[model samples]
Target: MMPLNNSMLITGGAGFIGSYLINQLIVKGVNVICLDNFDEFYPRKSKENNIKSFIASPLFTLIEGDIRNKELLDDIFKKQTIGIVIHLAAKAGVRPSIINPQEYFDVNVNGTLNLLEVMKNHSVQNFIFASSSSIYGNNLKIPYSELDNVDFPISPYACSKKSGELLTHTYHTLYNMNVINLRFFTVYGPGQRPDLAIHKFVNNIYKNIPIEVYGDGSTSRDYTYIDDTVTGILAAIHYLEINTNVYETINLGNNYPVKLSDLIEIIEEITQKKFIEKKLPIQMGDVNITFADITKAKQLLNYHPKVSLKEGVINFKKWYEKKLV
Candidate 1:
């Protein structure tokens, strides 16, 4: 069992889901060490704002660094008594990964390798990997399961996540590390990343800008709410605490797929603004649909997603409008 006093090291803890996860854990009085590089992928100011509330909290420690920096990671592990490493750092975005496959692999795969190595050296065995449903990659299967063949990832981002999972499994096998790779679907909600479709659509509609619609708006995504995703992560941490010799790949998703056209409609209805639709050809790395089978998550973690798309979208609208002011 994990010692209660050990700090939980969460990489990318300032990003969308990472910030939310850290918030929840902080509320629960868990000691958290957040390691983030504040990448220019988005405005660093926004990410900084995400964690502003926790700046004064005694339980929170923010380390500004990259996952690829082995010396920094080694120093952190050497000093901190970290019970678990919840890895959320990665070069996100399927299209961007296609353009910069090398960078994606460097950060996602090589960076993950660096973390695992440091964890091994320090004997920090418990790990929760933030995987992606994009690994399914235009799968013919309706709802993706842990058993699905993920050997055919289409994007470098997806491939990188798959590689991380494989590396975790290798560590689990060799070092007896307890690892849980949670494949998160398209997570969205309040404080959603500016680049994500939901946030982008809402913002564009609010600003009277044309929102890009690719592939006749047929592409779909299983949008999991941020709160539900955090719940699953916490559950995984608990399971890891109580269980050993565990290596599991589970899906933490809402199990409902929303089409691109329908998603825009929802945003319009919520924000009370109609956006000009700019039609474009489907991008190279874009997938047709993503639907997750969360039976394993339910059985293992007792995870049940509580927020509906409409409710979550409404929450996001409230947050977005407040932020705009």
Candidate 2:
């Protein structure tokens, strides 16, 4: 890989995926500037702990701010020579978005616009967006592809992500920016967000609490390990580095869909605990499935997911146990 000429700015850099991506970039001798507002969706300490190790590194710089603030974004661009912008900051979760649609649009859509405007003004052309598979909605397609028509989004969060993808493409076409929109599948592993199913289930089972199983446990997700997702992201960054006039939307996923019941069983076996399963009706905004077609990722970026669901769950278990100590 060619050496980066300037620092990479990752919005939401203190979050789960952002923190992991920053660690990898810094290890490769690349400078990183992480911007995060540390939203109240989860505990602030967890996000803080995510990037605690990187605080002292000369290659890492954390900016506590919101993406909606165009002034702050402009000031950041003016001060730092940023080579690439990985926009990962957004109002996440489908259910939460349904409860607060306006906030989702304001942050995910307008905030993205703010960043793009700043980047355009500063002439920073390289960009990568963290999109979501939920944009597929409840499409009948077994494996969601980039070519699939995603005109119908079921939830506000999904709509927000679809909006982000469109915004990136618009910027790419008008500004001649090199961009990639990566639709991430269900990502889980060590340092995973506490709100996610895997993390929540693991903790609940470990404590012998009843775990909620929405919709019959038949609903499935293409659970991609965090390492695999980050690998695909880095590959996308490299592709942007070596190519030009590029605008591609690709899926970074495990490609293997695991039903909710199977996921719980794996966690149960791994943690050596019995789970009290509380069945609940499928909540609104929750999709029936999320399976990714990574053929484009494989061909374009040579990306392949290496971690299996069981293995990833084991890794998370180890990390959670260590954290408890």
What tens digits encode model 2's per-residue C-alpha lDDT throughout 1-325? 2237899999999999999999999999999999999999999999999999888999988899999998899999999999999999988889999999999999999999999999999999999999999999999977999999999899999999999999999999999988899999988999998889999998888788898889999999999999999999999999988887899999998899999989988888898889998999999999999999999999999998999999899899999999999
**Where is model 2 more than 4 Å wrong at Cα?**
1-3
* TM value for model 2: 0.98
Q: Write down the TM-score of every candidate.
A: 0.99, 0.98
Q: Write the per-residue lDDT of candidate 1 for residues 1-325, one digit (tens) a residue.
A: 6776799999999999999999999999999999999998899999989999997899999999999999999999999999999999988988889889999999999999999999999999999999999999889988998999999999999999999999999999999999999999999988888889989988888888998899899899999999999999999999988987899999999999999989988888887788899999999988999999999999999999999999999999999889899
C-alpha lDDT of residue 320 in model 2? 96
Q: Measured by TM-score, how close is model 1 to the native structure?
A: 0.99
Model 2 root-mean-square deviation: 1.2
Q: After superposition, which runs of candidate 1 have C-alpha atoms over 4 Å from their true positions?
A: none
Enumerate clash totals for all models, in the order shown.
0, 0
